[model samples]
Target: MSKHSVVIFVSQRNSLRSILAQACLAHLGSGRFLALSCGWPGMLADAIHPAAIGALNSASMPIPNHRPRDWNDLARPSAARAEFVITLDETTSSFQPRWPGQPDSALWAFPDVAAAGDPEKVAHLAIQMLYALRRRLELFVSLPLQGTDRAAIRSDLRDLAHMR
Candidate 1:
């Protein structure tokens, strides 16, 4: 059987943190999980943030196509529903959608690194987000997912999301 899938959400522009988490998990999960990302149809950006691209380059991970998509784009009739839905910001966490199975979800609130004025700060934040998501995803992919430990798994994910 195929492994469970994860979807990451970010509000507003789908250019930074959410995209990073999606790429990071896809790189680290190694087919253990499928990762997808989307954002609200608010203030869409024309492309992914340059700093995000830089961070991915620094990590030697290939950047996904610099496309920003909304949640509705992926919620079509035949799309594979997510088993876990991770919201990368506060705004997205509050805007709940009627996911088919009401998948397990969590909100990991990270700062808006792409909006930071300085390029240096933007790069720093990108790196920080990349590593943090990597750690959380590592934990997630290691869980005894087939065992009866749903509560513990949720708790761990919640704790990871709240980390500073």
Candidate 2:
């Protein structure tokens, strides 16, 4: 039997974009992929953002049951090795750590919705990000990963970043 491909979503903070991506992939991957998420070292948030939780609840997606984690935790030798590592923000994309198996990596580049002060605005941005992530993840789960080479898969994921 074939094993599921493991994908990790990363961001400056695991509170918003990465969390949304992770939840969306977990829902859309259909047993073909294992999804996880983390934030940069020293940058993990105290909790998943309330806006993010509301967005997921509104969309009927599952909320992750864990707090934001440090990216360094995933770098440990005992950690699950990722097949792909995707950065959801510009900051994380610029400083991603090397994965154990040198997973195919890409930058999805979602904006920081946490920066918005107004509760309504934050919720709006969160939902928008969630929908955007869901669209990309739908395309992602449709990729022919079984027979594809590492380079080709990487290119395919990178190409998805160009979609609006």
Candidate 3:
């Protein structure tokens, strides 16, 4: 049996954070699990987000062909059932996906690093987002199936999203 299949949700696929998480998880996660990113049909067809690509390039984790996530990708016949659904968008606070089984869903919003006017500013934000998502994912993967650890992980993940 597979550990878990997770799908990540975001607003647009033209930016850094979601794409970075998709790229990172795809690289770091190996084939033990599956990771995918989905955004609304609001992404620009510019290959990849430039700053995001640059940041990944700097980290030596380049994903050159990341496009927007479509309904076909989300509701696919060959797609494995997702064990967890995580949303990583600021505008997705009320965003509820229509997953088939309605698996355990959570959100972990981070600032959009790609929108900063200054390159340095954007770079800093991207670094922050990368680390934040990495930490959250670490916490996510370490969550126990049952017991106090599971409760703690659930609470922390909610706090990461709802602690506004």
List, residue by residue over 15-68, the lDDT tens digit for candidate 2.
999999999999898888889999998888999999999999999999998899
Worst 10 residues of 2 by lDDT: 91-100
Candidate 2 structure, TM-score to reference:
0.96
lDDT of 1 by residue, 32-105 (tens): 77788777876667788888899999998778775988877766656677677788878666665666656777
lDDT of 3 by residue, 23-140 (tens): 7776666554467766655453345566777778777875736566643467465666665566676675464456765556676767666667898888777866766676666555
lDDT of 3: 0.62
- Identify the superior model by TM-score, candidate 1 or candidate 3: 1
- The TM-score leader among the candidates is 2
Count the clashes in each prediction. 0, 0, 0
Per-model TM values vs. the true structure: 0.90, 0.96, 0.75
TM-score of 3: 0.75
* Cα lDDT for residue 130, candidate 1: 93
At residue 74, what lDDT does model 3 achieve?
71
**What's the residue-level lDDT of 147 in candidate 1?**
63
